[model samples]
Target: MFRMIPPGLAEAARLTRQGRLKEATALLQGSLAGTRPKPTPARPATRGRIFEVDPATGDATPPGRAGFFSRAQGRPRPAPPLAMPEGARFLRGGFGAAQGERAWRLYIPASLPAGPVPLLVMLHGCTQTPEDFAAGTRMNALAEAEPRLVLYPEQSGTANAQRCWNWFQPGDQRRDQGEPALIAGMVRQVMRDHAVDPRRVHVAGLSAGGAAAAIMGESYPELFAAVGVHSGLACGAAQNLPSALAAMRQGGGTSTVLATARPTIVFHADQDRTVHPVNGDQVMARAGAAGLRAEVERGQVPGGHAFTRTRHSDTAGRVMLEQWLVHGGGHAWSGGDAAGSYTDPLGPDASRAMLDFFRRHG
Candidate 1:
C-alpha cells in the first residue's frame, strides 16, 4: 500500500534535488518548530585589520580592534579616488537639503560642446560616498565614450547613518520635498551650469539609490527622459516593511508615468537573494499600466545570469528597460570594473547599456 508524504517532506526532497538541502531542512524544521530545533551552519569568528583615513588630508588615522576596513574598529579610510574621466569638473555643492542636513558631490564632463549633451545622474547606495559610486559604476568610462555629463549627488551619513537614499520614507518620496527635490535641484543646477539637452537626461542607481531613481522618474517625468534602477523598487509601491516585502514578492504598482515629455524607463535586476527579481517585473508593469508601450526581451550573460529587456514607447521614441537577472547573483553591480565596490565586471556592462539607451532617446 502507498503512504502519504508530508508537505514539508516533499519540500525537503525538492530542495535536496536542487542542492539546497540545508535551506529546505531549515524550512521544514521551522514549520515544525515545537517538535525540534532546526540545524544551522556554524559561522566562524571574523577577524581583520582596520584602517582609517581622513577625507580632508587623505592620511591614514590608525588601526584598532576591528580589522582594517572595519568602520567600528578603524578611524576611517581616506576617501578613494573617484576615477573620473579626463576634463571632469566639480560643480557646486549642497545639492540635497533635507531635515537641516546638507548633501553634496561632483559633476563630470565639465565642458559640453556647442550642442546640448545628454545628462546622466548616478546615485550611490547605503554606506557609500559619491566617489565610491563613481568608481564602482565606471560610468565615467561611458561618459568619455559618449558625450554625456554625469552627476553624482551624495548622501550624508549625518542625515541617515546608513547613507541610504531615504526612498522608504514618505517625506523623501514626494516631489518638491526631501531627497527628491534635492535630486531635482541638482539636475536643474547641472542644466543651468551646462548646456544639458533636456530631452536626453537619464537617471540610474543601485539598491536604495535605485529606489530613489524610480521615485525621481515618478515625480519629475519631464525632467528625466529615462530611469535605470538596479536592484530596487518603485516608490509608494513599498513604504514600510510589509509593503516592501509584498512589492518584492509580487512586483509592480499603479503609479502614473511622470514623464509626459519623453518615454520613461529601463530596469535591471538579478534573480539572486538580497533584492527580489520580481521588483524588475513590477517596474515594467507600472510603466505599461500607465499607457506606456512596454516590451520584454530576454538573453543570457556571463556568470549564468538571464538578462531581460523591457522597452516603453512614447511620442519621442521607445524607452528601453534592460534587466540583468543573474541566476545566483546577489546585491551587486553587474558589468562593473573591479576597482569599484560590490562590482562584477564579468557580467553584462550596465554602464554601456545605460549610455546606449540614453543615446537612443537623445
Candidate 2:
C-alpha cells in the first residue's frame, strides 16, 4: 500500500536540513512506529507527600487515600512519577470566598516569562488530591516546559464522601454559589498574587473534576477563556444523586442552555463504564444547540489509540467546541502518565492538546 510520509518525520527532515540534528533525532525516536514510549519508573507511594491534603480542614492526609482505585483483581495501586519538576515551586494554600474556604495547591514554573502568563486551574476527580491528579496527568511537567502557571483546587471530603466536586448539585452549578464561587475565588487569588493574564485563564479536569470544569465554564465564562473536560459530563447534566447516577449511566440530562456556551474541548472513552460515552455526545449536543456548527474528524494515532474528534464552530468557522472520543479506551486521561490514577498512556495526550486549544481562543 502506498503511504504518505508521516508528519513527524516530515518535520524531522526539515529540522535535519536546518542543522538541528538533535531535535530532529528526538522527534524521530518519538515518531518511530510499533514502539511504545518507555514507562516512567514508578516511584514509591510515599513520594506523594505533596498531595496528601485534607481539603476540609487543610491538613495532611495519606496519599493512597487520594482517589478511587480498582485493582485488576490483585493489582497494586499505580506508582507516582518522580517529583515535581526541578525549580517548580509547589505551594499549599487556602482560598476564602463568601461561601467558604477551599484548600488549593499552586504550581509556579521557574521559567515564567515577564508580564502576565496563562493560568490553568485544574479540578481533581473524586477521592483525588491536587498532587495525585497532577502526577497522573503529568501536566505539571508540561507546565515546566511552557513556563505557565497551574492551580489545583481540592474538593473537600466533608462536602462529598468521595471528595468529588459537586457538579450535579444545583448550588454548585451556578455562579457565585457553592463550589463555583470558591474555585473562582482561588483563581482570583492566584491572579492577584501572580501576573496571570485574565484573558488567558483556562480550566480542565478529569471525571468528577471534568464535570465540575464544565459547570465552571457555564457558571463563570468570563473568567475562563476555555474549558477541557476528560471523561466528564457537561454542566446542568444532573440535579441530585439520583439524577447524577442516571446521567452517568444513561446520559442526556441537560437542564439548561446558555445564550452562549463557552468554548469547550471534551475527551471521553468509548469503552468507559464509569461514565457512559453518550455523555460526550450530550456535551456536543448542548454546544450545538447554542448555535455552533459541528465538524467531525475520525482518525487513529499510529501505533496508538484511535479517536473520533468533532470540532464545533460558528458561522464564521470559529471553533467553539472540540469533542474527542477515544476508541477502545477506558475512563482515564488520554496519554496520561502511568504513575497517576485513571490514566491511559496509549491515547492522545489530553494535557498538551488542551493547552494548545486554550492558546487559540485567548
Candidate 3:
C-alpha cells in the first residue's frame, strides 16, 4: 500500500534516502517549525477510582450509573460565566491588502475601564499560531488579571514553510521590510482603533519570534516602550549561516544600532541543549554598550531555573531587564502550562515575569 505523506516531508524523505541526510534534516526541521502535535485528551488513571458526591452534603457516594464522577456532596456547582473574559475577541477578517493574511488576534482586558490601556505585541515562534502561543503562555489570562491588551501577530505557513519570522533573512531583517513592517503596521492599527498609550507600546517573542522582537527594537525603538526576548539572540548578531551558528553556540555579537539609550529589555535563556545560554549574555552586553546604564543581576529559580537581569532605568524611572533562566531546561517556554505546546511549567513562571516587566516599564 502506498503511504500518504506531506509533500514537504516526502521530499525530505526522498533526499535522505538518496544519502542527503543533512539537506533532508534541514528541510524537515524547517517544515516542522512552529508546528506542534495535536493535543491528546487527559485520561484518568485506572489505579484510583473517582466517586460521585452529593450536592446537598459534602459526602462521597458510589459511582453513578454512567460510571463518572460528579460534584461532591453539599457543594454547589460553579455556574459558567455569562460572558467570556473581557477584551478577548477573535477577528477573522484580514487587516489590510496583504492577501492570505488572516486577521490578527487581540486580547484586551475588560478591566480597562480607564481610557487608553497599554498594548503588548507578542510574536509566536516558528510553526506556532497566536492561539497556541496564548494557550501555551497563558498571557491572555495574565492580561485579564492586569487589564492590558495583548496582540498576537501570526506568521502563516505560506509565507515560510517553517512558519518562522524570517528574522535571519537579510531581506526581512530591515526596518521597513517584510514582516517587520507588517508587525509595526499591526501595532499602529491597534493603537488607532483602541485607546492605547503611544509611549507604552511594547514587543516580545520566543526564539525566532524573539529574534524578530530584537530586530524591531533595534529598527523601531521609538515605537516601543521595551522589548522582551526569551531563548533568542540579538539582532544582526550574525550576518551568515556560519556566524549565526557560532553566535547560537558561543554567543557575543556586534552592537545594536538602536537610537535610544538603553531601551528597556527583558532576556530569558535556559542552560541546556539546542540554543546556548550565552546568547543571553550577548544581548545584555550589546544593550549595555548602547549608552544604557545596564545593571546586571544573576540568580536561579526553582526546578533549576536561573536568570540574569540587565536593567536600565529610563527617564521615567521604569525598570526593565532580561530574566528567567532555567538551568536544566531545553528549548521550551518557562512557567508555561504543561498541556500547551513545547512548554515546561517546572521552572519560574515567565508569563508572570513578563507581564510584571511590561507593567513596570510601560
Candidate 4:
C-alpha cells in the first residue's frame, strides 16, 4: 500500500514552522476530532502522552475535563489573604489599559529610605493569588525590613482558570503587547504613585510566574534592571499549548525574542518534575552576553539542602548571569515558608538571594 499520513498534522507542522501557532493549534484541535489517518513517515511517530492541562492556555479548561482550575497537582490549595505587618500597609489596586487590566498588591514599608527606593515586581505561579504568593515567599517581610516597594501583579481566574500568567501565549510573549504590556503598566503606575528609582526596578517570579518574569525582562530590559527566575522557562519557550508542553518537559527551542542582555539570576531544583531543570540552562544561554566565562561553586545551607551556583561573567568582569541548582529540590520555591502553598523550607532562601542579586545588578 502507498504510504499515507495525516494531512492536517503536516499542515499544522508547517503552520508552526511559520510561527502561526494559534492557527496550528486550531488546526490540530479540529483535526483531532476525526480518526488519526495512518502515518507514512519513514521514522515512526513517537508514542507518548502530552500533558492535558496545557490547553488551559485557552478556553480555561483543566485536564481531563472542559474547564479550568479543578486543582493543581501535588500542592495544597490555599488562597490565603496576606496579613499586614507592624508599621506597613499592603494596598490593593488595578492598572487598566486598552488590551487588558491587572489587579496588583503593593507593599509599602513603615518608612522609606532617604532616596527613591528600588521597586521589585513579583509574579506568582499558577493557582496562586498575590496574598498567597506574598505569604509563601515572605517577600513583604523582606521589603519592610529593607524598606523598599514590592509589587505583586495578579492573574485573573477569568483569564486563566488556574490563574496562571499565560506565559505560553505568543501574544503575551512580546513587548508592548498582551500580558507584558499590562504588567509593565502596573509597574509604571507604582513608579508614578511612589518614590521609585527608575534604574533600580527589578522583576522575579516562581514557575509560571517565573516564565512570565522572563518575558517581562526580555520585553522590557531597560525597565527591569535584573531578572530572577525560580523554576521557570526562558522567553519564547513556547507559542501555544503543544509547544509549551514540550518546552516544559524538555528545554525549549531557540529564543524567539532577544536583544540586549540584562542581569539575570535563575534557580531550579535538580529534581524538579513539573518543569525540567534543563530549562534553567536555557535561561542562562538566552542572556546572549559576550565572551561569557562560567565559574562554579558549591555550598550547603546550614540546615538545608546543598546547591551548585554558577556565575557567568562577560569580558568586562561583570557577572551577568547566575544559576542555582538546588540538589534534591522539587518544584516548590527554595527556602520558602509553608504558610501559603508550593513552598519548601529546606532550600536556600531564594527571596533573599534574589534581592541580593537585584541590589548588585541594579
Candidate 5:
C-alpha cells in the first residue's frame, strides 16, 4: 500500500537537506534517544538522604517507615532528563492568581532573534514533572533550534492525588476560575517578562495535560491562538470522578463545538487503552470542522507504527485542524524521547507536528 510522509517529519527532512540537518536531528532526536544512558541502579538507602515522598500528600516519609512504600512501589526509576540544552536556560519560577499558585519551569532558547517570540505553554500528564514532559516530548530540545519560548506549568500534588490538572472537574473547566485562570495568568506573566507575540501564544499537553490544554483553549480562546492535544479527552469530557473514569473508558456526553474554538491539532493511538481514541474525535469536534475542506493521508514512521492523518482546511487552503491516529501505539507521547516517562520513541514526532501547526495559526 502507498504511504505518505508525516508532514512534520517530511518538513524536517527537507530542512535537513537545506543545511538544518544537524540542528533538527539534535533537537528531534529521532535517534538520540537510542544513545540515552542506561538506567542506573538504585542507591542504598542512607540515613539522612533516604526519605520517601508520599505521592498523595507530597510529604516526606521517615526513612525507616518506607517499608510499606517499598513493598507497594517498585524501585524508583532514574530522574527525568533535566539538563539545560547548550546556551539555553531552564529557569524555575512560580505564578499565583485567584484560584491558587503553581510553580513553573520556563525554557528560553539561545541566541534568540530580536523582537517578540512565540510562547508555548505545556502541561504534563499525571505523575509527570515539567522536566519529564519536556524530555518526553523533546519540545525543549526542539526549541533550542526553533527559537520559541516554552513554559511548563506544573501541577501540585496537593491539588490532586496524582498531580493531574483536574481537567474533568467543573470548576477547572471555566475561564475565570480554577486552574484555567491560574494558567492563563502564567501566560500573561511570561508575556510581560519577555516580548511575546500575542497571536503566537499556544498550549499543548499529554493525557491529563492534553485535556487541560483543551480546557485552556475553550476557556481563553482570545489568549491561545491554537491548542494541541495528545492522548487526551475533549474539554468537558467529565464533571466528576465517576464520569472522568467512564470518559476515559469511552467518550463522554458533554458536547460543545463552538465556531470560535481555537485551532486544534490532536494525536491519539487506535490501541490506546487509557483514553479512548473516540475522545480524539470529540476533540476534533470541538475544533468545529464545519465548512472546511477535508483531506486524509496515511503514513508510517520507519521502524515505527503506521498512522492516518486527517487535515481540515479552509477555503483559502490554510489548514485549521489536524488529527492523527497511530495504529498499534499506546497512551504515551507520540515519537517521544526514551529519557522521559510515558514516551513512545517509535511513534511519529508529535512535538514537531504540533509546533508546526501552532506556528501556522500565529
Candidate 6:
C-alpha cells in the first residue's frame, strides 16, 4: 500500500518513531515557520463529514458537502445585535502597513485607575466581525468590569473569504511577519495611546483565531505575557491549507522546539466537530513538552456542561498551562451570550476563566 504524507508531518512522524521526542516536537512546532508555497487553485482534499447547513432552507445538507460551517443542525436562529457596554468607549480605527491596511475596533474603559491597566487583544473566528464577537463573547463587559483596555483586530474578507486568520499559512504564523506583525503592531499602537501596562498585555481567540493566538504567544513571548486559545490548534499545527485540512481531520503531525512559551489557557468542546477535540490535547502537549509538570482534573459546569481540566505547572508549582475540555459541548463559545454567533450558553464561562488565568500571569 502506498500513502502520501505531508512533508512536515512526515518528518515529524519519522522523528517521533525513532524516539527523538524533543527533536520531533520542535520540528512539528517550528513547521509553521516554513515558507509559504506558491498559490495553487486546487483545493485541499478533505476527509470526514462536512459540517454545514444549507442557508436557504436551514437544513443539514446530506453526508458530504462543499462548504464549512458547524452551524446548529437547522437554519440558525437570528442572533440579536450586541449592545455597546456601558462606561466603555467603542472606537474604530485603521492600521497602516506595507502589505495593506486593516480595520480595528478598540474598547476603552471610561474610567481608569491611577496606574496603567491591563490590555487584552481578542481575535474573532471565521464569519465573525468585531461587533459580533464582542457581543457573543461579552468580553466588553469583562473589560469594563476590570477597567482593562481591549483590542479586536478584524480579518478582512480580502485576506480570506471566510474572514479567518491565516493560521495555516507560513508567512502569517511567525513574529513580525504577515498577520502576526500586523496584530503585534496593533498592540503597540494601543499601548502608546493608552495607559496599558506593557507586561500585562495578553492575546486570545476562537478557532482559527485561537490558533493564531497560540502563534502570537510562541512568536512574541516577550510582548505577550499570557495567551488564551479557545477551540484552537497548537502553533505549527499545519503549514498550508491541505496540511491544515489533514490536521483538522485527524490531528497535527508532531511537535517542535519553541524559543519560549507564555502561560497558556485553552478551551474546547469534546464534541467540537469543526476543529476536533484532540487539538486541545495537542495544545497542552506542545506547551508542556519543555519539561513542565501536568495535573489533570475532571468536573462538570453547574447546570451547564461537564469538563476535564488539565493544569501544567513549572518546577516551582507555578501554573503554566490550563486546558479545559467541555464534555458534550459543541463548536461554540462556552457560556457566551446568545446575542452573538456560534456560542453555547451552557458551559463554564471561558471568558471569566481566561481572565482569571491571565491576571495571575500578568
Model 2 lDDT per residue over 1-362, tens place: 54343346555444433334344445545665523243233333222112111222222233345334521212224434447656768899998867988899899887778999999999987656787788878878898888789999988766764577888778989999999999999999989999988899999998889898988887787899988888889888877654565567578457456567568888999988767899987876665445677778988877889998888787888887898989998877898877776678889888888988898878
Error of 2 at 324 (Å): 0.5
Local error of candidate 2 at residue 303 (angstroms): 2.6
In order of lDDT, best first, we have: 4, 5, 6, 2, 3, 1
Put down candidate 5 lDDT per residue, 1-362, tens digits, no spaces: 54332233333333323333233333333422433222223333223311112222323233333112111232334446576756889989999976899999999988567799999999988657788788788888788878889999998756853567888789999988999999999999999999998989999998899999999998888899999999999998877654565577678666777764359999999988668899999999877876788899999999999999999998789898999999999878899987777777889999999988987999
| Comparison by TM-score, 2 against 5, better one | 5
Backbone clashes in model 4:
2
C-alpha lDDT values of all predictions: 0.61, 0.74, 0.61, 0.77, 0.76, 0.75
Where in model 3 is the C-alpha error above 4 Å?
1-87, 97-103, 240-243, 256-260, 289-320
lDDT of 1 at 124: 79
Please report, as a residue range, the 10-residue window in candidate 5 with the lowest summed lDDT: 63-72
TM-score of 2: 0.78
lDDT of 3 at 75: 28
Instruction: Please identify model 1 stretches exceeding 4 Å from their true place.
Output: 1-79, 84-86, 96-101, 245-269, 289-298, 302-306, 310-322
- Report the error of model 2 at residue 252, Å: 3.7
TM-score of each: 0.70, 0.78, 0.70, 0.80, 0.79, 0.80
lDDT at 127 for candidate 1?
A: 54
For candidate 3, write residues 1-362 as lDDT tens digits.
54333345555444433334344445545554734233223232212111111212313222122111112212222222223464466453245544334357887666666788888888877545677677768887777777778898887645654355767567667877777778888888888888998878888888778888888887787898778887777888765443454455457366554454444454454543435777766665665534444566776675456655556655565554544456666666777774345466766677887777766665
Candidate achieving higher TM-score, 5 or 6: 6
Runs in model 6 deviating more than 4 A are: 1-3, 6-80, 259-261
Pairing residues by index, what is the TM-score of model 3?
0.70
The residue-by-residue lDDT of candidate 1 on 21-110, one tens digit each, is 345445545544534345355333212211112112322222122211212222434345765546777564765344444555656664
283 in model 2: Cα distance from truth in Å?
1.6
Evaluation by lDDT, superior candidate among 1 and 5: 5
